[model samples]
Target: MQRIEFRKVIDLSHIISPDIPLWPGDPPVTFDEVASPEKDGYYLRRFAMGEHSATHMNAPNSFHPNAIGIDAYEPASLVRPAVVIDLRIQARDNPDYVIGIQDIEKWEQAHGRIDQGSVVLFYTGWQTLWDDPRRFINADDKGPHFPGIGAATTTFLLEQRRIAGVGIDTHGADPGQDTVYATNSQILANEGIVLECLTNLDQLPAKGTTLVIGVLRLKKGSGSPVSVMAFVP
Candidate 1:
């Protein structure tokens, strides 16, 4: 028999702080010191933030009616093989780009087909703009201007490919400027999970990596801020 060891664990989640970008009109994260070391001989703090803030996951019920909650996902389902589809070039050239079915086909041609239960993450290079909330959200009077998965592509992945879930380095799975948000609606209809606001995707290879999503097991939670990590062996 042989023993196994971890090669590396990369942090794919972003830091949750005041600087982190939040959805428009969302509540700001706050930290309060409950106890001081000098007074209580201990340090205690209380923090509060929206469930959808930072590196977070959307459960089926987040947008669906009476669907499963975040706590319902089994432990086995939280960890899965992951493939990073890089669209940095296109995203850099066009801020309002949407990853379409053609992009998925191109990736399948380069690599192998995306298997069932594999976590598919889109690398839009949006993490580079995280330092600036205005730019990261890319919003204006019209709406947001960030890259997202096209509705058709989301349908193909959730219905046809049957992937475990979809992850993005942006605000959400749908384009910010999309009024209808058909992609997100489609995912909800299928009871699909979504991981949003991911970071450090560049550190992982396009394939041959495992994604570990650590989320708070809040009962009936529509969503939860998650700590996303990658195990590379």
Candidate 2:
């Protein structure tokens, strides 16, 4: 038997606060101070936010009727081999960039085939602009602008590769400007899982890592905030 060892753990989730930019029209987050150690014996806080706020996971139910919710998947299915696809340069030049088939092909060529049940993360370096909501959303009269996976690439991963999940360090897996959400629908139709608003992906290697995703087991919830960690040996 091969012994598995975790040499390092890296956080891939963004800290959620009032400053965290949410999807337009989504409810704002609230953190209430219920008690303090100095006065109420122990510190306590009550908080609430949109289920999709911060680093979060989206189940197929987000789009497909009768599809599984965030709690339906077994814990084992959520832990899988992870591969990071770096496209920071392209995203730097064009914030509206969309990861295409060529990007996947090139990554596979340099590394190896993306094995089935693998978790693939797109590193567009968008986390760098997280400090400012305006820049992060990149919204204006023309709507928001940010790099994301295109419909074709998303379809290939879900249909062809049969990946366990996909993730990105943006508002969502699809471009903010894609009001129609065609790509998102395709993924959901294929029963795909998505982790959005990830951060610190640049710290991971191309492959040979395991992603430990922490998702709230909300009952019949479409999605929920998640905390993702990478175990690298």
Candidate 3:
């Protein structure tokens, strides 16, 4: 491969740490100092975290039985064309809003039909709550509430556009209340990547940004933490 040139780069990943909001039952992020300069000649630390926590990508195995893992994704496929659909106003009006086909069509009316193999992203203004776990999670007796792609919408994208997958600035690709993970499962079930907890969607335009998704090549791993970057044209 030739040396890659630089461009206006924007990071679309959340900073992972103990304080990052996590799934109700997922493993906690922890770091322990295994060696320090005071005790040893080197400074080193060990860390533990869940695959789905923080900013991450979900592979087919995450939802389907006996499916391929994160490592199976071809390197060339990881860097993909991406498009963002701004739904901040709708999400602000209703925290539990689910993006439907109509919303996607409305975006297309302005941005043109989404190209095949593109990764669609939804910017719901949720990134603003990153610092506040209380509001970011927004859980209640019912369940967590946040904006996400609807199952039917996911079906449309897969069938109509044959997109690579979808991403969101939330913990799950499905609406937070959808414990069944309808949207999340549907995408991965069809072997599409589902990027979650991404940030800086606000900085990306409706199109023209190429996504450079970085996922750990974990063998047979259901999912892996991701560092998603955008190269704006």
Candidate 4:
């Protein structure tokens, strides 16, 4: 007989709860102890929240009028090879920077080509400020400033790179200062999936890994909160 040993578990899910915080306008997630042994016969907890809070997925229906719901999304699509492209330097210098083709090119120059049908994650190191509302939102007299993909960059990935989806360590895949929501619109229109509010990307390697994302099966759901994990092999 042979004994088996597992390496390490890389938790990709962001902590969730009413106190986890959310995008300024989105409803806060809430949980209540509906049943307790001291108060009731058993112990149980009821939960309530918006589907789009915390680490979550954006279904095609999010922006398209006649697109498939979150429930219809194929399970195979949720699990795929993943790579992290570090953009902390760019994000630190330009809070409102939109990840572009040049960034992708630079990443490829360092870490081989991005494979087709792979999940491309942008690591901006923004999750460090998750506890501070001011820093998390980067709200100023002008407005919230954050890093994300631009319209052109997203279109390029969808059309040229043919990636499975895009993930980001930010509230949304689009920059907070975006007036038109260009990136989101493009992705949804192109039937592209998006994983948002991701954390702990810094803990994973740059390449040679797979990601497992479990999204709630909400009928006709535009999106749903997900438990994401990364496995290095």
Candidate 5:
């Protein structure tokens, strides 16, 4: 058995609440009191939210009609080495910026080639806007605009590195303006998972961290909110 050791843990998930920015028309998050300590000797709440709410993972079925769901993932698939690519400066310069081969090559020059089966994450500095839904979504008549992976980058990661998944601190894996979900579809087509709306990415190193994702295994679920934590060595 492979032993796991870490000196610190960084929460890579956002606190799920009613106000986090969501896709344009997804169901709103709701929390209702199911029982109160005074009345039932227990405090419990029932919450409802879209599968891809807050910090969430996307199953292949999210974009593919006949693909497997999140529950199909095995325990080993949920724990893997993770690498964070810092693109905050570039994303801030252009919200529509698409991570491309040039970007990946540059990152590799500095960090090294991305390892196979690693979950690659992008820190676009978007998490800073989580408090303001409008700004976070950054939508207008033209549609949302945010830095994200595109078809080319997604394909490179899959074909070259054989990445297990891709993640970002934005609401969508594809750039917000991409209604077609180009990146999502490509990644999902190969049975790769997608993580979004992640937080605390600023606390992570460029590489050498293990991601232990906690996802709700809803049967045939297209996706689910997740509690992603990073094990820092």
Candidate 6:
């Protein structure tokens, strides 16, 4: 007897909610009902939260001076072919691991060159322990210990590959340990974007996928929370 096979697809994005861990100092997400059928004629609710609360987009103005506003960013830039480069091995060994040139080289050696205009998503496997504050932040006397793209690697992707942007499964594009926000500053200055607080990347194939980031059109806003999704073929 012969068996038939079917393609399996997985979503590689996080669900944003009030309980999702947010960066310290940001206001907590709030939801309140303004009217209800029991009290009035209909039901209506209101929400209040920072733009950068959960899975979100980062505009040039986020770190650069007088950069493009979040609203002005082209919608076309939000969707693109993507490549997932796994750094879980290094991250497991070093919680503060920074994705570097060597990592890119290794990936290219196996998967060929990362195409220009691709949205490179780095998988640190940090999302697995996101619920634990201690493990998520790994805060200490020095600072938080989380993984992110190194300055050199980010620069290389921007200058060499001319990538559209970068994404990560961690809280920020810059590591919790980065003091200068080097990668963020440079990337934004170059008109490159960053998608942060992503999850479920382990379900995606390394290549042959597309990432769609839906950002709210906030007038003159620096950055905003985004509804992210991945399409696999």
> Highest TM-score, which number?
5
- Segments in model 3 whose C-alpha atoms lie over 4 Å from true places: 1-6
- Per-residue lDDT tens digits for candidate 3, residues 1-233, read 73334468999998888999887778899999999998998999999999888999998988888989999998888888899999999999999998999999999999899999999999999988988887988888888999888989999999999999999998878998887888878888777879988898988878988888899998998899999989887
Model 3 weakest 10-residue run by lDDT: 1-10
Per-residue C-alpha lDDT of model 4 across residues 98-204, encoded as one tens digit per residue: 89999999989999988998889999988887777568888777778899998899888888888888899888799988878777777777666789888899988
lDDT of 6 by residue, 3-105 (tens): 3232554555566556777777779888899999999989998988887777788888878778887898787777788899999999999988888999999
Clash list (residue pairs), candidate 4 = none
TM-score of each: 0.94, 0.94, 0.95, 0.92, 0.98, 0.91
Model 1 segments more than 4 A misplaced: 1-6
- Lowest summed lDDT across 10 adjacent residues in model 2 is found at 184-193
Q: Name the candidate, 1 or 4, with the larger TM-score value.
A: 1
lDDT leaderboard ranking: 5, 3, 1, 2, 4, 6
lDDT of 2 by residue, 1-233 (tens): 63446899999998989889787778899999999999989999999999888889887888888988888878877778899999999999999998999999999999988999898899999988888877888888888899888888988888788887788999989887777776778866766668888999989999988987878999888898988889987
lDDT of residue 164 for candidate 4: 83
Overall lDDT per candidate, in order of appearance: 0.87, 0.86, 0.89, 0.84, 0.92, 0.83
In terms of lDDT, which candidate is strongest?
5
lDDT value, residue 128 of candidate 6:
88
Better of 3 and 6 by TM-score: 3
Q: Deviation in angstroms for 3 in model 2?
A: 6.1
